[model samples]
Target: MTEMTYRQALHDTLREELLRDENVMLIGEEIGIFDGSYKITAGLLKEFGARRVRDAPISEEGFTGAAMLGLRPVVEIMTINFSLLALDQIVNHAAKIHGMFGGQLGVPMVIRTPGGGGQQLGASHSQNIELYYAFVPGMKVVAPSTPADAKALLMASIRDDDPVLFLENLALYNTKGDVPDHVEPAEIGKAKVTRTGKDLTLIGYSRMALVAQQVADRLAESEGLDIEVVDLRSLRPLDRDTVIESVKKTNAAVVLEDDWLTYGIGAEVAASISDGAFDYLDAPVRRVAMAEVPLPYAKPLETAALPSIDDVVNAVHETLDAVGRRR
Candidate 1:
């Protein structure tokens, strides 16, 4: 086991996957010569040559569309906000092609982008848009939390037959974790139970999972609350079985998402848990998410707009209160 930064883990995964699969190719802005904006594709251009790891111009929509023509293209948009500029290609061509063409055509493409607001990148660049791509029917939106998840799911995403939107939180790039050298790809739609408990379940994705762990620790230390934490790694094609299974055991839930509260991934998971695990529920399904609005540029206001440790802690307390399980 070796500790590696989140960005290095992803870069290693891409390099490893490309070496493993001959069909895997990459195309995006600054990916080859510039070594990617975050250096996630660093050194690939030198090793694999320009054929496999090629760079594109400023056209996010155009090059991305061209890259998804059939090959398993790993197109890395500089930022998630920039992906909206290429929405037409992702939605119409890459996403809709497989199902639309009666399985004749394939869209084994992975479009990776950075998101979330804690970096003070302002409203446009820092917003979490995981739910936006999750809303699309044919796309698999993956927002991995740990270095392991980032590495494993990226390889999985590259190999997926459907279009997979891999959202890497910009703030998570420098975060370090122990990564296994002989790790295999994890399934896209499966949810992992990060921390096991009998009291309540805290569901989160991406960087929010780190915050969830911190929130879980405080609950266990101070309130003696044992919380089951689920990392909803794949937002779309959500692992309903995993979440429903947890809700069945705990009977209480608090979903923590970094996106807006109105129609965030938390809302979807909450609704599903209610539908599938209704009889087991002892308290109302509580959701702690970002405030619904454009992210503020000011540090304090930006921090306020983003989901925090306090929100998760308070939500857990409220959930326990509702269930008469507060200690």
Candidate 2:
């Protein structure tokens, strides 16, 4: 019932989960005395002691693989760009250890990292690696868009049996929203519709959902389009049912995404709509996404690459116009 920043909610969840489970331990850069780069683990070291809240050196691959040897390590990279350093451990060991060893052991680990662009942190640190991780087997990918989702999903990931890639956007750290103390464990592969409507469905992930919500409000006021907005907090094993059901009722859809359009999660959602909800479709599904270029460093070029609220509005209008033309 209290409001908290997404970062605070995450920190609270980590502390609570640690209190609930002794097997859980965290290892990452600056997570201990420094309280994490984003302060998500602030004050945790004081509460749990140094053994639990470890500060690994800059070697992500070494510490990540070593942590997976036994303890249920929660490896939090300061940024997702640094995750590439541990890709071998992630792709080879964490992802394949149990399967390769014929179920002798399971890597009960959680890899947390920050992603996405908007803070002008430049192009190097802003890539959304969800689509890449979704390609690998034996790994679960999650992205929480709200304070509630951030807390609940991270708690669930901590208790999960397999290795999980939990990605938080750098841009969402300061975003404030309501979260309850008595939160339940959220299922990892599910989706939630933040706002319901009958005209059209707007699917978005992470920060893009906020963008779509803004566009949804404008569409209702200006264009009379009662658009439904779906917040897909989980990326891998996605909650396809929520999206399919919304599109069935609305008869049209527009996907808003911040990643490059090619092979992005939005493309997967669009394909599923065409395959599963083809009969209910009134118009071709459209997506508003980043352009296919290495994210630019300059402000103007970066702004042009990313989708905006206006882009979502235009996509909705285009879908409706095409639907009308069919008659």
TM-score of each model, in listed order: 0.97, 0.96
Q: Residue 160, candidate 2: how far off, in angstroms?
A: 0.1
List candidate 1 segments past 4 Å from native: 67-70
Clashes of each: 0, 0
**Model 1 C-alpha lDDT per residue in residues 154-233, reported as the tens digit of each score:** 98898888889999998899999999978888999999999999999999889888888889888899889898899989
On the 0 to 100 scale, the lDDT of residue 47 in model 1 is: 96
In the range 1-327, model 2's lDDT, one tens digit per residue, is 999999999998899889988888988999999988888899999999999999999998888875445677888987888888889999988889889988888998999999888777777887877787888888899989999999999999999888899989877889999998689989998999999999889999898988888898987887677779999888887888999999999999998888889888999999989988999998899999988877888888888877887788778888989968311
Model 2 TM-score on a 0 to 1 scale: 0.96
- Candidate 2 Cα misplacement greater than 4 A, ranges: 67-69, 325-327
